[model samples]
Target: MALRLKSLTLASFLIPSNRNDWDRHLSAKHNRILIVDDHQDICASMRDILDDVGYEVVVTGNANDALEQVDLTPFDVVLLDYQMPDMNGAALLRIIKQKQKAVTAFLITAYAGSTGAQDALNIGATAVLQKPINVVELLGYLADAERA
Candidate 1:
């Protein structure tokens, strides 16, 4: 919850650099977003940034909380952390899909090309975003997801 992100850890994932991106961001108000990460700092940082740009963002530190959020409200997009104590990102995405079939989800992990990370793609992730998220790339995905 401390504002320690400093555009270093989260990087472009929290900053909107392009003008066109801002225009598209207006419509992001309609998009609901969920972030699942065990790291409280990252989750809070992402939530703050995305929420500022008009997204209805919800962040959780564990799978159970993430599941509870999914049950309470439908989200248009999800960012799932690949490594967690109870369950992996792929398994969680599978369960989330069962509840929210149309949600556009991304698997976020430090290991991008690992077998487990690749396995997530088959399960139904829109993309695999490497950790220490890039805000620009994330927004691009959101824009693309919106267009789709």
Candidate 2:
């Protein structure tokens, strides 16, 4: 079955917290992605786009839950929102990198020239994409990630 996750809010799942203990769950055939944003509509739009292209997508509205999901499963790429209530994209990208450095991350933000976007890029984000994303460009990024 095609994996599709939408707006997961529950907590309390456990996986290895350290990268050494975690196993890469994705295979060559599985192109899994995680979408983290506070806005449900944004997540839904991204999910629809990715799912249509046959990617396994999971989305969460909060950073903590996104972290938990990352800990549990290996994702090829992460589309992270730049601003959220609990944490910013840069901070979340740091944690995600710590968990799995191989994962490609893109910071999604309306404020492309802001400090946060620069910070995210500094911390190893693959790219910083403006909000109201262009589906063609986003898919191109995903295609690149899939190749890597």
Winning candidate number (lDDT): 1
RMSD to native, candidate 2: 12.8
Q: Best-fitting candidate, measured by TM-score? A: 1
Model 2 error, position 38 (Å):
0.7
**Residues 9-62, model 2: lDDT tens digits:** 222122224544323312225488999999999899889877765689999998
Any idea what lDDT model 2 has? 0.76
In the predicted model 2, the residue pairs found to clash are none
State the C-alpha lDDT per candidate. 0.78, 0.76
What is the RMSD of candidate 1? 7.4
Candidate 1 ranges with C-alpha deviation above 4 Å: 1-24
lDDT of 1 by residue, 17-127 (tens): 677757665755458899999988899888887787778888988888899999999988999999997888989999999998888888889888777777777777877
